[model samples]
Target: MSQVFKGCCAAFLYGVLLATSLGGLPASAGEGGLYRKAGGIEAYIGFVPAEITQGHAATQADKPMHDGVPRGHHQYHLVAAVFESDSGARISDAMVTAQVSGLALSGPRKAMDPMTIAGTTTYGAYFELPGADLYTIVLTIKRAGATKPVTLKFTYDHRNP
Candidate 1:
């Protein structure tokens, strides 16, 4: 009955609809082309060239938010859209972090910034790929009211892509 509750319901339904329509989309839709469903969550991830984020920075109204994107060689923009496995509700408020590692190389954990687009919120951040062999992208998601965090692992074979 409350406006807030109604709005959230609408958004949840929209997310469900979007998830259902995923089959029609190309696997390489976001250039990075990655999707996975595990631990009762469906994660759609895209890791592309960081240069694309420069365009986003130009459109940002806040100067501080613009510099959040890191710069480095073989850097890529990682965007992740996570949803409830059954309800299709988008989880926007979760604290998302991603760590990139391959072979003996590993980096510190970096928190993902929430980016809202068309009324939908997703998580993203910049990371180095270095054209390194196969890199494992491990995402740790912590949601409010949930006792344990959800972890998702994805493999990025930079050479093939």
Candidate 2:
């Protein structure tokens, strides 16, 4: 019991130190928050379209090593994270959706289900590209606390060379 208590205390202190270093920004203001600041969801979607295309092409042509495995011709995965705000450490239940155009892909636009974590939940959707090209991605989020739904648009150009 004492060891557990000590571990918890250390974690608490570490969190405090980290928060202080980060201007007291909540941990949720981490990656997802960064994504939001960089044009929010729309900007991220735009970046992904190209990333997926180029990534697929590169994998096919080079047959290069990736993700600790060999490359193959396959559809790229579209992962997304919907957060309330930079300080919103917890991901509330929200209706999140994603869609892509200019690519041939099929999968559930929304995540399997809303996931709850320590203080946040991320909705991730998986998709496969039909062909290599620039694709448009749209994301929409709705939560009870939010007065309006947050929507984002972006494009990606996948190229693997």
Worst ten in a row by lDDT for model 2: 39-48
Task: Give the per-residue lDDT digits (tens) of candidate 2, residues 1-161.
Answer: 68566656644553343224332334344343224433222212212222232222112334421221223544443444453354544444667677767755443454423422233344433455656676667677666666787766655665451
lDDT of candidate 1 over 59-89, digit per residue (tens): 2565533265577678786778887777777
Query: By TM-score, how accurate is candidate 1?
Result: 0.71
Clash counts for all predictions: 0, 18
What lDDT score goes with residue 54 in model 2? 28
Prediction 2 global C-alpha lDDT: 0.44
Task: Using lDDT, give the best candidate's number.
Answer: 1
Q: How good is model 2 by TM-score?
A: 0.46
Q: Model-by-model lDDT, in order?
A: 0.68, 0.44
Clashing pairs in 1: none
TM-score of each: 0.71, 0.46
After superposition, the stretches of candidate 1 with alpha carbons farther than 4 Å from their true spots are 1-33, 57-61, 64-68
lDDT of 1: 0.68
